[model samples]
Target: MERRILFTIMLTSFLTPFAGSALNLALPSLGEAYGASPAALGWVLGSFLLAAIVVLLPFGKLADRYGKRRFFIMGNGIFALTSLLAAFAPNLPLLLAARAAQGIGSAMTFATSMSILTLVIPKERRGWAMGWNVAVVYTGLTLGPVAGGFLNYYYGWPSIFIVLAMIGGTAFLAARRFLQEEWYEDTSPHWDKKGAVLYGGAILLIIYGLSQLNSQPLAPGLLLGGLVLFFLFCRYELRQENPLLPITLLQGNLPFSLSCLAALLNYCGTFAASFLLSLYLQSILGMTSRSAGLILLSQPIIMALLSPLMGKLSDKYAPTKLAALGMAVISAGLAGFALTIHNLALWLMIPMLIITGTGFALFAAPNNNAIMSAVEKKHYGLAASLLSSTRLVGQVLSVALMNLILSLSWDGLSLQETLLQNLQLALLFFALLSGLGVIPAKVRQ
Candidate 1:
């Protein structure tokens, strides 16, 4: 039963990251097919992330109130359906809408999966289970580019969505058949509708505003409005008996809060590295999607191999220290990228990717163990959801930063030159962000 449950959760875990990394390799193909500008391509990616971030916390709370298994099944169903729809989308607008809906499905699965894992697994082996979970996620990342590139090269970008749909359907069936137990913290039927609206609205405005930085007249206004709404959301949550998010978690829990902050900074600094690198390889170096993907596989391969080991080490050592060390390693890797941008031979690029991947594995498993360990069993769903939310939010910001940089740099240079400049600047900025994150990771109680 334990193995089955772990297998099911691990299967579901593969979907989102696979979709993300695979899509990264396919971006250039997508842009050419749709005649999309870099800004529009950013929208294609950002739409899914924004939708996921807005809904994750709410779904997490809902999972706690209702049942994790029920929502997990439903999420897989929604994801499968949306992947099919995305495959058939004729226009960019339809595709974006499908991706947004898929994001909602991703939130449901992500919000509940780790919570369920923590519930069923014994305390002693929890880190090991979590480690394997993180490893499978990297496995997905490892396969996505390779598979997505192969499919895109032979069939078209649409085939990628078709494959995702099949995988989602398989996971849905497996979860429903093999996982019979339902886990719920609160059986109350009450819903926090107002809090949901306010929180969702704030995230939408903020991410949209950031994506439009220097590109639109209303960017500043949208950002200000989002901040105001966020403030209101925080105040309102504090007053509610059944809040959408537990305000006290952030206000009172130092370790949990700092772990979350570290996650946010870590993802913000590293998530877009693939996005930038994909474009650099395909657009700048004129490599095919297949070739670029093969090169990109170097990083996640290391991540997949090392994550479980890191998870085991975290069980014995201080997770906080390990996480802090990971952050420093990540900062070094990002700096390596920036410094070697001018002379990116395969020898240099592959080593840098391996270093970054190792850092990611070190950080992800230990940091996750820290976050889950900080909360009680009842708050597991909420903690999982919040952690996932922070990750998606950071990813959105990372991509938005890249979009802003690309828009700013495209004025007077050739496309290749512009991309090179964007790569250097973005890597430096991300290195600094990762360096800053180490402080929070180190100080977490």
Candidate 2:
């Protein structure tokens, strides 16, 4: 059962990043083929993330109420079908819609994968198992751009989706065959409809409002309204006999809350670097998609290599201390990236990538350990959902911020010096944010 679960999760884990990173490299080609603006291209990624954020928590709670195994299998099916839909999308709107559907599928997997793993793995060996799991994630990311570049260069962008569909299908079949266990945290018959609606609505409002700040005049109003709804949702959850999300996990738990915040900050600091760098490599440095992908591979490669060792170290040492150190290293790496606008050399950038990757490897598994360890056994699904949500939120904010910066100065046609300036400015902000995250890590001490 453990081997089956491991294989199932590892396969699904590999599929998500394999699709995401590859799609990032294919964005330029997609733009040309579909006549998409930079903002529109950003949405191609943003739409998917938005959908994930909306469903992650709600579905996680639902999974606990029903059965995780059933939801996991269903999610894999959704993901596979969406991959096919995305591959055949005839227009930009359809493609974005398909991506959103894919996000829902991904949310199903992301929300429960960790919880299920925690259920099966022994407590003492969890760090090692999580390390290996995270390693597969990085391995997928490591391969994504390289494969994406080659596929786009040879066949076309659509082939990426087709290939992703096949991968998802394989995972789905493997899970269905080998995975026999059905784990449920809450077997009693109950579901939190109001909490689910309020949570999803608030997320959509906030994300949509923030994404529209560059264009819409009333975007701030939308954001404020969303915050109000979110507060109301929390109040409602607290009062419920059996809430969708137990408020205590976040409200009373300092370690869990701080760890979540750190995760959000870390992702916000690092996620958009690749998106911006991909553009810089192809447009500014005149590298082909394949060559740029090879360069970008350096980061995740280091991450994949270091994750297990870091996970082992976390088991022996103070995870918060290791996580804080990792965040500090990330800040330094982002600072290095910011410094490179004036002197854009591949040599300098590669070292910075290595620094950030190593830091991320250190931060990810250990931080996950801290969050999961802090929560109760029953709240594993919630913990996993919240952690994944934090990541998705950070990613959305990173992209939205990127779009806002680009919108302020860019005209969407030609690459200019201002784009690099905006990128540098963004990196500076990320470095500051990552450095700020270290405060929370230390506070957990």
Candidate 3:
């Protein structure tokens, strides 16, 4: 059962990132195929993330109240179905809808998988398991670009979706057959409907607003509206006897809160690395997708190699300190990318990627270990969901920032010096954000 659980969770972790990263590499082809504008292409990615962010926490609570294995199997089935939908999409709107459906399914899986692991895995070995879990994530990311590029180059972008569907179908079958045990800590009939609505609505509005700031006319009004509603949601959650999120977990717990904040900042600073670099390589440097993928391979490959070691280290040392050091290293690497990427020799970029990957490997598993360790057993589902939420939020913000910059600085995929300039500014801002992340990571309970 434990091995089955491990395999299921690891496969779930791999597919989500693989889908996202592979899509990033396939975006240029997608644009040509669908005649999507830059903003529209961004939405192809953003729609999925937004959908996941909206439902993740609420679904987490539901999973705890119901049964995790049930949701996991259902999610995998949905994921596979949605991938087939995406592959067959005849238009942009259809494709976007398919991606959104896939996101909802992904939310189901991520919201419960880690919590399930934390419950079943012994306390002493949890770190190692978490490390392997994160390593699988990097492994998926590591392969996404290379595989996606080759697949796109030879078979077209739809092949990516077809391949994803096959993997999802396999996971679905494995979960249904082998993972028979159901884990549910909360059996209460209570479900906070109002809190869930407000939470989901606020996230949707805020992220959509952020993405539209430079491109749309009413961005400020949308942003303000989302913030107002979010504040209301917080206040409402505070008063609920069984809040959807249990605001107290964030408010009263120092280590957990800070760890979440660190995770958020870390993701905001780092998640867009591949998206930005993929464009830089293909659009700016005029490299082929396959060739660019080879270059982009440096970071996640290193991350995949080092994550298990870091996870084991977190078991023996202070995870917070290790995560802090990783943040510092990330700051330095981002700065390097910002300062020298354009003028530096192409080969020199590999070292920068290695440094950045190392920092992330050191940070991810340890930070996740800290967040899960800080929470109690019953709140494991919530903690896991919140952690994943933080990551999705960070990713949304990262892409939002990228789109905003591109909207203001470039148009129609035309190559211009300003494109590089805007990208550099974005990298520098991310470095600054990462530098700030170090503080939260170092904050002790």
TM-score of every candidate relative to the true structure: 0.92, 0.93, 0.93
* Candidate 3 residue lDDT tens string, 210-319: 87887689987898899999999999999998899788878899999999999999999988877778778887788986788788888888999899899889888889
Worst 10 residues of 3 by lDDT: 406-415
For model 1, what is the C-alpha lDDT against the true structure? Answer: 0.88
lDDT of 2 by residue, 288-394 (tens): 86688778889999999999888878888878998999999999998988887658787787899999999999899889888888888889999999999999889
Residues 1-445 of candidate 1: C-alpha lDDT, one tens digit per residue: 9989899999999998899878876889888988888778876777888889889989998888889999999999999999999989888889999999999999999999989988888877777888899999989988887788889899999999999999999999999998899988976668789999999999889988887777799998999999999999999999988788889878898999999999999999998888788777787777886688789888888988999899889888888888999999999999998898878565678888988999998899899999999898888998999889888889878877877777655678887777798888998999999999999997884
lDDT of each: 0.88, 0.88, 0.89
Question: Any runs in candidate 3 off by more than 4 Å, and if so which?
Answer: 279-286, 405-417
> Model 1: clashing residue pairs?
none
Q: Model 2 Cα displacement at 23 (Å)?
A: 1.7
lDDT (C-alpha) at residue 155 in model 1? 96
- lDDT comparing candidate 2 with the true structure: 0.88
Question: For candidate 1, which ten residues in a row score worst on lDDT?
Answer: 402-411
